[model samples]
Target: MSLIYEARSSSSLLVAGVARGLTTQGGRLVRPAENCWHMVVVRQGGEASMRLVGPWTGAGVASYGEGAEILWIRFRLGTFMPGQPVTGLRDQETLLPAATGHSVWLNDAAWPLPGIDDVDAFVERLRRAGVLTHDPLVQDLLHEPGSGLAPRTERHRLLRATGLPLRHIRQVERAQQAAALLGQGVPIPETMFRLGYFDQPHLTRALRRWVGHTPGQLLRAGEEHLPLRTRPLDAPSLH
Candidate 1:
């Protein structure tokens, strides 16, 4: 069975999607978005039976499983592969960017990257570091998602300093804090108290506006990408 494993974009410099346990017959996808830079990883889970269908068409795909459950992951950096066209043009394209608060599907020619080996191995380094799955609350931010995303197109002046749009930095930071807290399974009521919201409703509004979903939705999205791990909630002082 072929399916998208997970998809999500945080208020950070990363946007990601993953697929696992695809059918032996390799699948194709046409992406119609301008991803400044990103990585694509392919991991072998079981029954190494798949192949790329276009562009570098007929190229022999790497084999994983049996001898070893091969995990392949691709890394695409915004600065590195600036607007690299998606090659293996397919018929279906269904992806949406979480930030920018807008989404579009391309009817134009979509070029996707060719094949590769184990996607998991690429992430193994992050796994070992206390960084990957290390922070639980990164996803349960207490502020608004829309607050930061609306003004953060790389075309801004102030955003460059804060690494995010200044018009919405404070809100994004708060939401980031809340996301971190939620990942630890911290109760929402208590989080509201800690974040100084008038009530759950107030926080809920912020969550919806800034993050594109409720706190629970943020956590689920993170979980779908990878199991969130816990850590000390030493958020920076709100000076």
Candidate 2:
């Protein structure tokens, strides 16, 4: 199986990236822990579907047929569709009704799906239509890490913008970081130390829950040294 991925450039502050990919010989795709939401469009043969994926706190699996073309806009941690709170969609996938000309319904209005090259333009259109908006405090808290906002106030702002607690976000980030380190051939014990895990078992539990792999399995797969920088969390276990 082969897959090609590209990160599209975007100017919208709410969008993290517009990622486009094509999978030939598709099978199962494992989505690891993450804090952001994804607006995904998948096309197989002549049929296409659009959906919104909310923050995933644990590992999950998805399957696609061969020759599937997928395009997704991954929103930044603290952004969501206006009038649709992400908290309601946490750990869930909500399908959007398809409209004419490859468009989809968002808030009962038709939203045209732009080509990979037109992501910035599409975002601009959403902004003009008042369908995309974000809380300014999220940017402030993210960029100004040292902001002295009161703890209670900061927590409220974070919940409003990201639909998740700070602790959950940290857990997801740490789990992803651990996966990257393992893919680089780091030993589990060392990775645990580096990431401040309590012990090997602690690391193992986090990986199993968030990355869907045990350390030993990840290490064995790393021996093949695949070109893909990111390891597939769905990789089979050695045990």
Candidate 3:
């Protein structure tokens, strides 16, 4: 059987989005590189597990078990858990220990496994408890680079908060924009010019590395391209 997936936008500033997937039979899916990280909960065979997934820089394949249900809380860039530094989480995951059937150990306490409807409240609790935070400077610097901090300090803070350098994050974001445009039937030359890619091959290579599909493939793939959210081409930040 094929896996079913759904996603919804979140109102919380700390959250980028939320998504859930279910698999009746085991299968592999193409997971695209992401600009932000996520906290994922998986249920299989009557057991539940919570894991912190980090930002990915390249395309990868993820395997799901038969009869698996997964929920992902995709956090915004620069939001991270205190003590569970995002730096060490790049391209990897940290599986939290189960404190009980309904909760897991995080930041020295039990955090209940949240259902789909409870995500916002759960994140609010983490923020109140000092387990979740956002680095405003890092996010601000990315937009226009006028934080007033020394170059070295800014670099350190960026790496610590997002687990990738400024350039990589921008590149990933750009590639995602390109993919979204191509998927929406925009011509290749138009996409290249709109997003500031040097040429068609430059756009193609970036898409292949980050989106796991070439321009033509993305046009053909449509909404079935990746498991993550496809950003809007007109999003103000992309320009």
Q: Point to the candidate with the largest lDDT.
A: 3
Provide the TM-score for each candidate, comma-separated.
0.32, 0.83, 0.91
User: Can you write out model 2's per-residue Cα lDDT over 49-164, one digit (the tens) per residue?
Assistant: 88888788788876666777778888887776668787877899899888874888887798877766677788778877777777777767765764587989998878867888
Cα miss at 141, model 1 (Å)? 19
Give me the runs in candidate 1 sitting further than 4 Å from their true place: 1-164, 196-198, 215-239
Model 1 lDDT per residue over 29-138, tens place? 22211211233223344222222111111112222222222112322221111122333122112232222222121222222322322234433433344222221122
lDDT of 2 at 223: 27
Q: Model 3: how far is 29 from its true place, Å?
A: 1.5
Better of 2 and 3 by lDDT: 3
lDDT of 3 by residue, 123-175 (tens): 99999999999998777988886688898999988887888889999999999
After the best TM-score superposition of candidate 3, give how far the Cα of residue 176 lies from its true spot, in angstroms.
Answer: 0.3
**Using TM-score as the measure, what is the rank order of every candidate, best first?**
3, 2, 1
Model 2 ranges off by over 4 Å: 139-152, 223-239
Candidate 3 TM-score over all chains jointly: 0.91
Local distance difference test values of all predictions, in order: 0.34, 0.76, 0.84
Give lDDT for model 2.
Answer: 0.76
Name the 10 consecutive residues with the lowest summed lDDT in model 3.
230-239
